[model samples]
Target: MEYKIYVQNLKCGGCAKTITNKLNGIKGVSNLNIYVEDSLVILNCTEIILEKVKETLKKAGYPEDGEQNSLSSKAKSYVSCAIGNIG
Candidate 1:
């Protein structure tokens, strides 16, 4: 199944790159696409792994839309963004 998850704190190509790398690491995930402009993460994976995907996004500081966007998450996202930019 394919899922479209709108997330928070997506800023630029750096954020997109980080999200892409993170989601693609998931075993059941494929066709990962991150639209930073829209704060969206789209991917194809098994329904069972959907929660894992969302969790991964949150851990990476890109919590799903409507979820908590805490200060810690924003900080983590900035770090992730910098790392993504470097990579």
Candidate 2:
């Protein structure tokens, strides 16, 4: 199955990298694609694995579609981007 998740605070390549790293860690995810401009994450996986992906994204500071991002959340994304760039 394929899932499309719109993640808030997904602003740059750094955010995409972070999301990719975390999601790739999951056992069943495959064909993962992160669209930074659209804030969309596309992937192939089972329904059960889909929930795990959503939870993982939320924990990683990129909440799934429908969730509002706070100012702090946006700030955190920038910080994450900076760290990702450095490392």
Q: Pick the candidate with the highest TM-score.
A: 1
For candidate 1, write residues 1-87 as lDDT tens digits.
Answer: 889999999998988999888888889898888888889888898888999999998999999999999999999999999998999
What candidate 2 gets wrong by more than 4 Å, as runs, is 68-72
lDDT by residue for model 2 (22-80), tens: 88999999999999999999999999999999988877778887876667667777877
TM-score, predicted candidate 2 vs. hidden true structure: 0.87
Task: Rate residue 80 of model 1 by lDDT.
Answer: 92
The lDDT for every candidate, in the order shown, is 0.91, 0.86
Clashing pairs in 1: none
TM-score for each of the candidates:
0.95, 0.87
Model 1 Cα shift for residue 63 (angstroms): 0.4
How far is 47's C-alpha from truth in model 2 (Å)? 0.6
